[model samples]
Target: MSHTLLSSPLQGFTDFKFRNAFNHFFGGIDTFYAPYIRLNGKMVIKNSYKRDIALENNTELEVIPQIITNDVDEFLFVSKYIRELGYKELNWNLGCPYPMVTKRGMGSGLIHDSKKIDSILHRVHNESDVLVSMKMRMGYENPEEILDTLPILDKYPLKNIAIHARIGKQLYKGGTDLGAFQKCLDNTKHKMYYNGDITSVAAFKELQERFPSIDHWMIGRGLIADPFLPSMIKNNTTEYPKNKIDIFSEFHDRIFKEYDAALSGPTPIRMKMLGFWEYFSQSFENPQKTYKKIKKAKSVKNYTIAVREILKEAKR
Candidate 1:
């Protein structure tokens, strides 16, 4: 059976610039989910989010706009906004585990409130024509929380539910509970897409074997850690290209230059790339040393030199 691979949106990473660069250099993801748009008690869409999903910015990609909100009005407002932009689908984010978001009764925190989930989905469906999809953790406190919520979700015409197997509190720390994921499959009538910890070709194959029924897979940090992973999984190969370092160097430079030009100063760009290197370093020979090299570069000139040296050594 054929499969579909999706890029799961990370808040700070996986924006338009990174998506376009990854698609250009890697070329395996079938679609990309833009990071969730948070309204923050205001109905107005931020300029940054608008640019991220603008048709012109994402012309080469099949992009889906996502929203993180518990309010029906915010959901409807965003749905209308994206619909006017010619988007037919909007993904709801209920998987974020950050304390700031969860504490406010959004993200994974919303998973426990079946009534609220029901009420919001009810209003959105009744008032809007835009298709709705969901990205969720099993529960904020435990795995079974999703079980209660899935029944309510079945009442609506949702596009699909993409589940990240770990509960909210784990916060990407532990192993994905395959057993809990299996329970989700048994309960939901809707199409289920698997997400979490798919970092390599071997890991993907293991997941494919375990969930033969699932066709859609969402790759998050794994895609950033190694941009080549989606294509490798698609080709069913374990080998990197002969010019692996060269390809990666180009990919790295593309996003860096784009971000450098877009960001105002050396500090913002440095912090930005540093956030990415936390994952990108895993692609190198020495993860810790590679990250330290990037982290220590306080100036743009020094940062450029550090990256050049790191990729140079990677070539050898």
Candidate 2:
């Protein structure tokens, strides 16, 4: 079967600017899932969230909007909102493991309550015509939570289910439970996709060998850590471009320029770029030293210097 690769929704990093830039410079991802839109107490969807998933800005890539909400009303609201924006599909986020989200009985936290999952799906599927897919972890606290929830999901005509093989409590640490993922294949008839720890060509190949039938894959931090990873995986080549420095330099500059224009001051822009370096620094040969230099940069000039040094030391 032909394989399709997706860029997993990362709350801060995979915004429209990053999506457009990545597609322009390095094209491999079949679709980009937008970060989950959190509706405020006032029932307002933030303009920034609206702009991020707007079809006008995302003309170059196939994009799917994701929402993190346990409230059926909020789900219906977002569904109507996105459908109005010309989006045909919306992905429900049940994989976020952060405590703030979990404590609200949303994200992976909702996994422990199968009835809530059923209720939300029942209401949304009945009320909205928009196609809904799901992105989730095995469970929030226990590995078996998804087993109970999958049956509930099976009753709905979901577009697909993307499983991140670790339970929510694991966050991004530890190893993915391939054994459990194997069980997932048997439990449900819904089309399934694999997500998590796809950091290298070899890692992806290993998973492909283990689960050859699953042709859909979602990559998150790995894609940020190495912008060339998707292309490298598709081409089946471990070799990165010799001109990686120039290519990355252009990508970095575009993002910086966009953020600088939209954000208020140097500090906000500086903070934004620093967050990216947390994973992006891993792409370098001397990751610790590279990120340390970036962390110490108190000014934009110093930050630029650090970035230039990072490009000079890009892993060959």
Candidate 3:
């Protein structure tokens, strides 16, 4: 059996444009997880969400649509919507840690209540035949929260279960608890995918050694921080592409151009690229300096110059 590499979706960052551009430029991820589509207090699925999963927009990559909600109705609506678009799989995002989402008893917050999960899963599975997978944290308030939820989950014929080792409240702050994850490995019989803190090849190798049984891996911020990581892990090499910087430049330019055309002013475009630089700069030598310059660039022309300079520094 071979290892499977998956791209974990980041809400603001992993839209179709980014997924398409990343696939075109880097091409390591076996499947791209689109950001979770929510009803946003309405019953309608937004056009923006539809565009992200549109088959025509994502021709270059195998993409999975993720839906975030604790409501049975919302889940069913998204299920029918995507099935109409011809998608076979729908990923439930029970793992989002943000306060705004969790405050409403959604995302990781819902993981605490087994009964709620049981109700939601029962209705969605019975009402529609849409294949459902889940991406989640260990718990919202405690590591043991997942222990209680797994039995409820096991009752369902879920396609997959991807677990981020940290609890929701930790929110990417602390190291992943592999020990707790080991407990998860012991408890659940479902096919599992390990996620969180796999930023380096060495780290991934270490986890691979620790959990030889878990072949599926979901990468989120780490992929954003280092786009070449999946390729490195897949090929089992420390060496990066010789033209990595060049590839990154093309990737950045394409995303920039796309956002530039869609967005209104220099400010929105600059702000959008700045959000990417928050991660992309970490892949470079002088990350702080690189990010500072990019962050300070007021105009798009200046932002372009900053990027050029960063590329030059990367070459050196």
Candidate 4:
């Protein structure tokens, strides 16, 4: 299979609308995996998770819906639901490291309990008619701890194993544990895809040189950081990614206009728009100045005014 690059889910950032708009403008990601559906015991999806990946007629990209649960029935419930919607693959989120998720004996927390992992995977695979995939970290508290569970995962017929290389306890704070990742490649019969810290062309190239066997690469924060990493990785064509600051202002205004209408209030809209600026600032000539302008805006009116003024200055 000729593999295509993909965008990993980043909770609030890369939802249905964001993916639709991104693929419309900049062609990079081959397929997107939606944020995990946090289901209750009744095998019913929470409303917010349901909304995050709900397919629209306008959503044109290839998407794999995902689920987060420790229960086999919930896993089966999600897989069946997505399959009926025409998605052939459903990814299981074993990588989320948040305390709340882990505390519930879900996400990476389940990695420690091999018997449960074995039981759940066996039951889900035996029951589900759709393809099952897994996204995971190296381990929960320590990288080597995952080694204990690899034998169990190898028994199941998984579509692919996407490893983030960092332990769950580390969250997104530390560097990838390349040693543990290498161990997975060495031991597991299942095919592998790499994810983590791929924020720039150079970093991606280094990963390519290091592991030429890998066919797919997934980006999370980096996609949001620049919104152009996929194009950069795919075609090496962002050789001249638009440097003019005015264009970013144009992009920001366009997204903000959309968010304001869809979201409930100014606080939510403002927070979302501001989050984009964290990565958007990297596109500026003076990153610090542009970031401050967005960060310091006092009101919704001021935010829009600052955006317009800075965009004008960008033309100078």
Best by TM-score: 1
Q: Sorted by lDDT, highest first, which candidate order results?
A: 1, 2, 3, 4
Return whichever of 1 and 4 wins on lDDT: 1
lDDT of 3 by residue, 1-316 (tens): 4899999999899999998888788777999999999996689988899889999998888899999988889899999999999998999998999999988998999999999999999998899999999999999999899999999999999999999999899888978999999999899989999999889999999999999999999999999899889888888899988988999999998999998998898888999999999999899888899999998888889999999998987898
Query: How many angstroms is residue 154 displaced in model 4 relative to the true structure, after the best TM-score fit?
Result: 1.0
Question: In candidate 4, residue 1 scores what lDDT?
Answer: 30
Ordering by TM-score: 1, 3, 2, 4
Minimum summed lDDT over a 10-residue window in model 1 is located at 244-253
Model 1 compared with the native: what TM-score? 0.99
Model 3 bad stretches (over 4 Å): none
Question: Which regions in candidate 4 have their CA more than 4 angstroms from the true location?
Answer: 1-3, 242-250, 310-316
**Can you write out model 1's per-residue Cα lDDT over 192-220, one digit (the tens) per residue?**
99999999999999999999999999999
Model 2 steric clash total = 0
For candidate 1, the clash count comes to 0
For lDDT, the strongest prediction is 1
Once model 3 is optimally superposed onto the true structure by TM-score, how far is the C-alpha of residue 15 displaced, in angstroms? 0.8
Tell me which of candidates 1 and 3 scores higher on TM-score: 1
Question: Per-residue lDDT for 1-316 in model 4, tens only?
Answer: 3446888987777777777777766668998888888776886777766666667632688888888889888888888887877778889888998999999988888778889989988888788778888898888988876788888999988889999989899988978878779998998899899999998889988888888789899988888777767886787654745563544455566678778888897778878878887777776567789889988986788888877776777667
TM-score of 3: 0.98
Q: Relative to the true structure, how large is the alpha-carbon lDDT of every model?
A: 0.96, 0.92, 0.92, 0.81
